[model samples]
Target: MSTPKIPILMDVDTGIDDSLALIYLLASEEAEILGISCTAGNVPARQVAANNLAWLELCGRSGIEVALGAEVPLLTPLRTTEETHGPQGIGYAELPEPRAELSPRHAAQLWIDLARERPGEITGLVTGPLTNLALAVKLEPELPQLLKRIVVMGGAFNYPGNTTPSSEWNVAVDPESAKVVFDAFSGLPANRQPIICPLDVTETVVMTPEHLARLAEAADSSPIERPSSTDSHGLRSQTSNPLVRHLVDAVRFYFEFHFDHKQGYISHMHDPFAAAVALDSSLAVLRPATVDVELAGTLTRGATIADWHGLWGREANALVAVQTNPEEFFEQLIERVGAFARTIPGI
Candidate 1:
């Protein structure tokens, strides 16, 4: 029997890992990208869209449709943390001028239209704030029924948040939006409800040295090199480091900044892991449960609380992934990176 192709719609902010995840999806033999919608999250809304187009053009996939999504959070002011993403989200790679034209339709509408076109056949991999998804759910109540699942990379339950002590950056940036998406998915009809993969599980998935090397290999193949390392902003330092070449250096600097300042030893390839799990459940350990998002707590807003003990005896409303086979995930990620590394034009 032929392998079934998975249709995916990526909602991203074009963070470094987000770029890597997009490349993985586009190159995966089992995946057929439906489209991409850019949102304002880790980076500014304008930069996010530009970064998306840059990645597509770099990969020689200018044909993919790019939809610009929400600039600010659904019900909150926009939040940006350059400390985590560096000045530029994609490692200060001095992105080339965008070649992939932005779509005429908005991200929310694009999402709804695509969902309706292939009901129950599409998986939504969200790696940004919940603004776009929440807006889509609000506009089309029937959207939940059309998606196969929504694997989100936000919220913290057992693990401490990267932003606040209890709230992850994505969720904390827009708790109201997160609440809306969570409620919609939970309230959907039995068969229409999508799965939730909050940071409770994704936090544990980190990238290894092998993963970074693969990414570097891919970056080294970029055809367009910036004239200088200090982009227009004078942020990145010019370097002749062989390990940090072209775009790879930007990512390396970003990684080092985190390591030196926050002591974050591992790059938790968070978003892509969530996407991978949605594509292949065999990569994770999922448990059925009732996941409650805290929106009013002073310090816990955006935290995902799971009734894992069943102490409340509440009916399970979602599937929450709690663990993963790290070995399998890294292997798959490395393979995907290798394929993309080979696709760089004239490499």
Candidate 2:
């Protein structure tokens, strides 16, 4: 019998965690990636697009469609910090230049087309600003009904944000877009499961030293491609040389960025947590709740106020992730990485 097809669409900013999530999704036999929509945040718009393409190529799954999303927030200025991904987004991978043509139809339009083509069966794996998604809903107004779910990596319920005191990076980048998605989702009935992996739950899981070492070991042993004189590290050789040197460098830079800048040794696998939860709902403890985005406030803009107290007797519109089984998630992540590693050349 043929494997059952699980269709998924990804909206990402191509950060290190986003790359990990991509790898995880590709490794799973449960999913058939329909496409990836690139947005801006940790990297520049163009670079993030390139990073997405490079990852697709590296996975040997170049048939996946890659669409470029909004470069700036719907109602806010574009914000990018190299702190998380270096200037290029994939750390210092100095990724090979992408020659692929950008999709003519903007990400929002592409989203609508995909939903209209395969209504009620496509899952949105969102890990960046919701500009493209909001644009789609605002333009069509009937898309929410067609979506399987929106797995978003944003906001903060129990934990503070990485970008601000009360705002997560994805939402903080575009609160207006976030509000649009939340409102549209709320307008939909409870049948549509809009699961949110907020910072509170995501931060609970971090890239432990052991996990990083394992990932690095995978990269070191892989036969993946390497960068040349034009790439970041500028190393040139092919005889018994590691092809995934760039991946190891990316991990090292990611760790250093967290350690030196955040004063934390381990960075939260925020985006991947959302992806994992999206792939397998049983991996985390989930609850149904109503969530609202704070669009205006001196210090609380972009805050996701989840109503778990039942103080207002409000109906629930979102599924809030309360907890996760870290061991299970890590085990699955490691297994996927190992599989990819075994396919690489020159350990």
Candidate 3:
């Protein structure tokens, strides 16, 4: 008998890396994307839904259920990273407006209803704030047990924060919701616990211009384009392949941002790496820990703390990614997404 395809319920903010993550999952033959839940993070929830719908239409995979979540965090005021992603959250890429309609159900209700319908079969992948999942847990207390497992891309355990000196972007966006999630998901079995892709490891998964060129080459696109720092800012890719061109344009803005911040002209593929690890946990070595969110602090609100030792006296609630082979990961990403691009109707 053929092995069953893994059901993936993805919750994303549809930022650039989140876009790549969505495409990467679509490329995987074994990943059955049950549905997508859009939330406010990189951009607003409405724009996020539009971005997702457009990408699905662009990739010729329409009709997939896309649900919109909360417009703001549970407690904190909503903040978006238009500077990091573009005004539309996809940088220079311009996709036509989607023709598909969104699911009528709210994102939180979608999550709860899916878990109830597919107990122990659905795996949650959240690459944004835990707002929707938190709200879902509040409505359905047995969510953690009903799902097979979860993979999250947030936090800054043992690593400096990207948002502030103490907090990562996603957690910083919604600490109360994160607290709600961590508290609700406590004490799950080790294998079933959330596999969190913290900044400690995700910051190491860098994507250079050469990687984009390689991705284009993998798709057999002409000219083998390489974006350069010397080029004018906002310079777009004129590659023969449309998908590669959009990817180049999107990541070119990411490269420029990193260069301006003195982190080199390399973009961190955080959400894509999280998506990959969600599909195959063997790609990285995980260390079990009792993790929590710091909700109230003089200057450390929204920081995530992981107790590697037994000081917390709590059972391990998360399996944190500590190490991964970047080369292997990029290889898989290029191979999968690039080949999938080749199969597009217009390609």
Candidate 4:
């Protein structure tokens, strides 16, 4: 029997890693992406939407609706990581000009509408700041209860943060919104509580040079050829498969970012790991914890404080992923991505 595709809605900031996470979800057989909501983090909200639409076009999955979300945090100045994802929010790659426009509805409304339409079925995955999600919860107070699950790719529990000494980029970019989101879902029942893929687990799943080379090899083996009528401006027209070429170009910048930052030329598969866990919770070792986002601290703002030992005397409200098998994760990624590459039209 075939496995059931999990109905999902993804909220992303279109960072380099978020793009990879999008590719992972688009290629996977286990996920049925209902829509993608874009927000500001790695770049501005408009750029995030553009990147989403371009990526969907590049992957030939333009049917998925890409909706623009909050441009700034609820109570903070917007912060972006252009250095990490580069201009246009897709690293060194330049996708085809999107043939489609943004969905007519805003991301928050899409979230509310989808949750109401598919109550108790849609699994919402967030790989960016929580601005859009917080707004949706505010619009519909019972949004948390309507969704089957919420998988977040942020925080730095028991690990040093990437944005600051105490905060991950996603939460640091919008702590107030993150706080609202955490508080909203933390009150859900045990079975429906959110699952957080913090830095502790995501950092363990790194994409090495070897993996990139393997992906390129798989793409090269594909029978697809570039189309004669397609325009090649801003794209690597030399590669037979546009999707594979775009991915390689995009990851090059990410690889350099890690190398210069002393991470040994490997990119952290943060968002992709979260995407994987969203589909298959068995991909990671999870522990129940009472979690909250720190909004005010001289040196610890935006920190995800996960009380694993019940020291806070609070009931566990989230599942914190502590460990993941990198080998298995990469194997599955390679297989799914390879399968998708094979189906790409050579343009």
Best by TM-score: 3
What C-alpha lDDT, on a 0 to 100 scale, does residue 63 get in candidate 2? 73
Compared with the true structure, what per-residue lDDT tens digits does model 1 show for residues 1-347? 77689998989887877876786786687888888888898788778888888777766776677889999997778888777776778765766787567899999999999999998889898888888899899999988878987878777767788778888888888888887887778755544445666676765676544455554454454332333223343244343322234345445555555566655645667877877877887677677766667878886777767787777776666776778876678778767765665656542
Screening candidate 2 with a backbone cut-off below 3 angstroms (N, C-alpha, C), the clashing residue pairs are: 223-344, 223-345
The whole-model C-alpha lDDT of candidate 1 against the native structure comes to 0.73
- Cα error of candidate 4 at position 233, Å: 20
Task: Answer with 2 or 3, whichever has the higher lDDT.
Answer: 3
Return the clash pairs for model 3, or none. Answer: none
Candidate structures ordered by TM-score, highest first: 3, 4, 2, 1
Model 1, poorest ten-residue lDDT window?
222-231
TM-score of model 3 (CA atoms):
0.98
RMSD in Å for model 1:
4.5
The digit string of per-residue lDDT tens for model 4 on 1-347 reads: 88798999999999888999999998998799999999999999999999999888888886798899999999889989988888887877988898899999999999999999999999999999999999999999899999998999999989999999989999998998888888888767776889999999899898875686667566665433232113232333245577877776777677777776877666898999999999999898889999888987989988989888999988888998998899899998888897798788877
lDDT of 3 by residue, 1-347 (tens): 77569899999999999999999999998889999999999999999999999999888896589999989999889999999999999988988888899999999999999999999998999999999999999999999999999999999988999999999999999999999988888888888999999999999999999999999999888778888889899998887777888889899999999999999989999999999998899998999999999987979999999999979799889999999999999999999999998987544
Better by TM-score, candidate 4 or 3: 3
| Worst ten in a row by lDDT for model 4 | 224-233
Cα-based lDDT for every prediction = 0.73, 0.77, 0.93, 0.86
lDDT-wise, the better of 1 and 2 is 2
Summarize candidate 2's per-residue lDDT along 8-104 as a digit string, tens digits.
8999988888887887888777878898888888887777888888766665666788888889899888999787777788765655666566677
